[model samples]
Target: MVMTKRQIFVVFMVLVLLVALVCASHVTINEEEEADRILQLPGQPKVSFQQYSGYVTVNHVAGRALFYWLTEADHNPLSKPLVIWLNGGPGCSSVAYGASEEIGPFRINNTASGLYYNKFSWNTVANLLFLETPAGVGFSYSNQSSDLFNSGDRRTAKDSLEFLLRWLDRFPRYNQREVYITGESYAGHYVPQLAKEIMMYNKHSKHPINLKGIMVGNAVTDNYYDNLGTVTYWWSHAMISDKTYRQLINTCDFTHQKESNECDSVYSYAMDQEFGNIDQYNIYAPPCNKSDGSKATRQTMRLPHRPHQTFRQMSGYDPCTEKYAEIYYNRPDVQKALHANITKIPYKWTACSEVLNRNWKDTDVSILPIYREMIAGGLRIWVFSGDVDSVVPVTATRYSLAQLKLETKIPWYPWYVKKQVGGWTEVYEGLTFATVRGAGHEVPLFKPRAALLLFKSFIRGEPLPKS
Candidate 1:
């Protein structure tokens, strides 16, 4: 067929435009993909799922960035829900603890030689995102040193919410996926605060986050209830001496804004008595054999104990996983594979940064009010406690939940796993409370199978298996 010169010219221009569009789309995809891709870790096992680690700048002016590690679901990544897991140190590394140790698809083996598929990995049904939040925690950092000093609850939530929204631009696939924020310890504060931020944003946002629910384990939800329940647990468990208990009752005021001199002295003595030789996170569990010891006892300071050790889930994971993680993360090849420490961080990458913890400011004393608000907003909330965790024990969680005073939707009952009792569960209108039979501060680490069952039931909005 013969065509006129004008027709040929028009066809040529259309083809050029199509090519340009395709090239632009390719650039966008590859830019986001290559920046976060993980080829392989030093000793990681081959996996069907894709994993990514990189920084998302939260504050460009301050050069502050948060690090995230995301592992897609092995079977159907696109269909899986997105779970963003944060570790609670106010200064902890979620990637180091949550991703590498507890609920990640693979737990860094004790020797750090290779990875093995975690039989109970949460990612089996969800895309799990582990974030080392706040500047100066793990590999996340800031150029302005003052940013670290100003870190706290409000700032953390703002930064995290911004990080999530900004992150959506990079991985648009998850922009509309349902988001479930889960964490333990200080994350009790982080998760709810972040969830509240999302809820607030939803009020004004045209493109809102698809926030569905939240889960927290051994969380620090309230100052009064948390402390009241903690001291009561310590005394009831025979952890502190009778005299010390008496002193705690008479001299210590858990409701006090700051500990009095007498309370400080008594509390120090009680802590030393209970936690000196073992893990306070799990009273019955053995101490970490790797680290020297908690900073409380390291010096001769008679001051009250400070928060230390983001080495979480110590009860279920290898007490020495911290040591293995240190060995693995510090390897040059491993960092290169993960695309970490690109700016040549000044210090070695520690699992938890004391600087971040020390510099934290504006942290909430309690998150109870936020919990009330979120629950009233019809957001699903689940609070689970590890029975054996003395730091934030089942007792403390029960006391906190009691404050909600929500009548039981489902009466407390034993939930079974594999024909054996895994734990007891209580359902409330806005919440579900469960206890891992003998798990420690970190439930998944110690009771992986049971933890998985709990998570599965949670996403499905089902009651724990009674039979």
Candidate 2:
């Protein structure tokens, strides 16, 4: 029980070294986070929440980096769950849609001259993270041009996983925080696919992502079912002529992976002729009128040789909000404020990438398999449809969910918000489906109050309000 002086000195020195290491690690993380913080956005109204934006390099050799914007909860952020939002064109910018117009706290003004508060921002309840995924979307990019040209579902999922892993290291406080993934349109594939990767990674990693659930709106689920449902929606809603509907049903073989000329002709006819100048994403909403006094041009997806390339531009309550996002984000001062486009990307910022959309290498024919796997694993899964969205209508979602054949836990019924019928909901054995009454493709933008209520219910693992 006698300790020598040298032994005591060695133990003292070891303790000092450990403390230094800990302090150094903490300082480094703080510095990295501070470097990405946004002091103030151009013309932004005063706000209490903290905002950060920057890039995480997911591939060094390819020099691929993804941009992200984080809006901490309005109050007591540490107590809030972290929700990541994605927008899917397989090439769309979450920053443009999710942050600028939908769930993020700020909305771009009509003139793009200033920012205004969104009363229904999801950040009121959760820490919101918006990602510009798969380089070539928004401010994200790759030094290897081919990476942009050849991006696909598999690569996108892998890159996004890498981004999350590295991003968590930068913001270690959220490593064990409850996390939920959400998106709309093609992110039907992105959200589920990314969750599957996270689940798989957790199996072997000592530090696992605290992934709790996932929600997607107007999502693309299955090729056959989605296509079948889309045609049916047009016919039922009287957006397309019966002849056009029949042609679409008979010519476009949803089960086939390749596009046929007859299918292409009929599909184009339905959009160009039968659909008129109205916004396809929101059947009842007015289309964006150009400043030059011309009608809004149709922006349909008509890829010649590709399958599952049916995503069109997602619009908002202000049909021209996407245009305003383009004008705002491309500004030098705005980019500087948010620490984006640091590499001086060759192209202007856009809501969606045309090159990536056209050149997307792979598309999943069906995402129901992943749904089944996740449901069996007991993860909270929710799929919501904006009832008025013709692109991915309520009928399409119903058709896709029907393929799952899940027993109904709660029979379909109207869900209320503020004593008004917000939508209809039906809880199944392992999944929850709801529709946002009169909402468009971008539910949050078209029906923000209802969307936020649905989000609150999703994270709470509670049913939509019955009253």
Candidate 3:
């Protein structure tokens, strides 16, 4: 084999190009060094800093990058539990829920008015940390905008782990503090996986994570159970009809090997109950639109984007509604809290829809197995649910808890806060199953008072406030 001058040159050029492409694909990596973020909430309870703005460099698909200006907790260092809050949607930002709606220093006054102080903020008892993770959420950005899309559970957990490492490095004091991971919805997947990873690393790493317990609300831990639970939740809420319920059982076998017409029928029924409009129903309940050229649907469903918002117009925007949060987040003070350089990227606090234009591989991990592992290793496991949620019902959480088969050293009982019964708690199978009384899927939002109480007790290793 003889190598000609021209061929060799061509081969060399191709190799150079390949290397250049690889470099260009990952040019935006970075880490933080002694940075501070500040926020101010006008007319809210006075604190040294009304907002929390900090930076942590993360290595993801885009290499080194900084996630900037997530909200912080009020100083209660003595009893402050290091709490991490996560928002679901698989692509949703925790900054939206943790800061704007639930237990942040401020609350959105959706009437285009201004910000309001949340008297029941969780920070009063714990040091909360809200993160916009995976290097593409909220203030978090990468040199590669393409990094914004195509994300999955494994990547999310890894990226979050990096953020934790960096965060702990910056705030080393909390390394040995009680760390509790809590989130809602899709976080059902995120929190459990992250906790498992932390627990695993702690077992063998030179620098172990002082991992404590985790809590999820209206969480989606088991896809199969969750899908069926959706039907059950809706039925319990009286959101669907008896006829439709019967149709689901008769036609759809939840355990069937394949998707069937019966399943389609059940889905359609649920959709009709949710949103009456064919256009609106497609967003979340697409399977329920199949009906005979029938009379008008039972009742036109509200737009999925902000149905709960409209439903709670007279009351406060149901913290459950994305609209409620968006309306408040769009306020000027809220923007100040963000501290993002919008010139670098467009920051829309509330996305137009839930479907994220991203791609990523799905991993198979079970919370029950992870729970058992953590328990075996002497790590605490807490599973909390909002009783009123129709999204991830309390029943499903109970089912997940039962699978662990841990002994019931502590009996089920009520816990109290502020002299008012706020929720229930129990110790079973070496895990705690607690409930927040008036919350929805976004437990903190709907039940901040109870949520704060729950967090305080968690950090102190005490029983929850009983109702």
Q: What's the true lDDT of residue 16 in model 3?
A: 100
Please give the range of 10 consecutive residues that has the lowest summed lDDT in model 1.
296-305
Highest lDDT scorer: 2
lDDT of 1 by residue, 356-459 (tens): 76666676766888989999889999999988877777777888788888988999899999999999999999999999987888788888899999999999
- Per-model CA lDDT versus the true structure: 0.81, 0.88, 0.60
lDDT at 314 for candidate 2? 40
Regions of model 1 farther than 4 Å from truth: 1-26, 274-276, 290-317
At residue 35, give the lDDT of candidate 1.
Answer: 80
- lDDT tens digits, residues 187-227, model 2? 99899999999999999999889999999999988888888
Residues 1-467, candidate 3, lDDT per residue (tens digit)?
99999999999999999998877544422123223445354444456533445556676456545443333455657445578887665566676666676667676554635666777877776677887765565556666655665566787788788889877766666678778888776687778788877876777789887777787666666545554565565666666787776766566654332357657655665765653433221112212222363322212111101122112111244323345556565566655655554444566555322324234346343456666666777766667887765546776677656666677867888777677767777887667778876655556766666787776676677766444
Winner of 1 and 3 under lDDT: 1
Off by over 4 Å in 3: 1-34, 39-45, 49-51, 60-79, 111-113, 250-262, 273-337, 351-360, 363-365, 415-421, 465-467
Off by over 4 Å in 2: 297-316
Candidates sorted by TM-score, best first: 2, 1, 3
Candidate 2 vs 3: which has more lDDT: 2
